[model samples]
Target: MSRTRFKVILYLDETEFSRAAAIYSAILMMNMPNMHLTIVRLKESNQSLLEIDEKCQNIWPTTSDVPQNALDVFLARSKDVQQQVLYSNPNIPDAVTALLAYVNKWAIDLIVMGAGEFSKIKEVIFGSLAYSLQNRSPIPVLLVKELSQDFLEGCNLTPTLTIVPKNQHGN
Candidate 1:
C-alpha cells in the first residue's frame, strides 16, 4: 500500500511576511511526519519561464544542500523540503494566473504565505501578495502574520531564526 503525503507550498521572498511564512511552514512540516514542503517564489519580470526556473533553483536550494548563508534556519531543521520558481508578466492578472497554474500543477495541498506587511493604503490600492494569493488560489492558505516573543522563546530558536516585523512598506 502506498501512503500519501501532504504537500505544503510556502510562498517565499525577501520580506518579513515571507519569513513568517517560512517559519510556519517549517514548524508545521516538522510536526507532520508525512508532509512534503516546497518553497515557491514568483518573479514578476520579463524573464522567460526557463530563466526564472533556473534562478529560482539557485536561490531555492533543497534543505540538505542549502548554503549556510541562507537566511532561514528553520528550514535546515528538516531535510525533506524542496524549492520551485515561477515567472509571470508584471500585471496582477498574469501573476495570479501563473500562481494558480503552479498550484494545480503541483497538486499542492496547502498554500502558506505571510499576512503581508503592506500598509492599509497600499493594500487597498494594490493588494499584497498574500491577499492576491488568498483571493485567487484554489487551495487553503495559511497566512502567518507575526511571531510572538513567547513562541520564539518556547521554540528556543537560534539567532538565524529570529524574524522581525517590517515596516508598512515592507522595507
Candidate 2:
C-alpha cells in the first residue's frame, strides 16, 4: 500500500511560542515522508492579521521559548518540515470556519494545534477549540499538550487510523 501523503495544518495563535513547540513535537514524532506544514494565525482584524503573521513568521522557531534541547531534537529529527503562514479575522467561530475551509481547500489530512492554557471558568463558559475540533473536524485533529513529546508517538501506534472524507461532515 502507498504511504499516505499528509498535509499538516499547524494552527498558529498569538501564543506562538506554545504553538511552535507543539508543531515541533508533532513533526518529530509523526516523521511522515510526505508532509506539508502551514502556520495559521487568527487575528481580530485584517491589519492585525498581517502584523501577527509578520511577527510570528520572523520570531518562530528562533525567538520562540521552546527549550534548546527540544529545538535541537526537532531540528535533528524532522528534516522534512515545511512552513507556510495564514491569516484570519478574530471571531473564534469565524476563524475556525476559515481554518476548516483552508484545510479542505488544501486537502489537508491532519490538523495539529496546541491546547492553550485556559482557566476553568473560561473553559466552562467558552468551551475549548481543541475539544470542539476533535469532535467536529472532517479529518483527524491532533490536539497537542504543551511541550509534550510523546503524544504523536502514541498516535503513531494506534490501529485503524481513520481518514474522514471531505464531504463526510462539516466542522
Which structure among the candidates has the greatest lDDT? 1
**Clashes in model 1: which pairs?**
none
- The C-alpha stretches of model 2 lying farther than 4 A from their native spots are 1-4, 14-30, 46-61, 65-80, 117-121, 147-171
**Which tens-of-lDDT digit does each residue in 22-104 have in candidate 2?**
54654444455456455455546554323223444433454354445444444543444444455556656556666677777
Model 2 scores worst on lDDT over the 10 consecutive residues at 152-161
lDDT of 1 by residue, 120-153 (tens): 8998888676778788888898888977778756
The deviation in Å at residue 19 for candidate 2 is: 4.7
TM-score of each: 0.72, 0.58
Question: What is each predicted model's overall lDDT from 0 to 1?
Answer: 0.66, 0.57
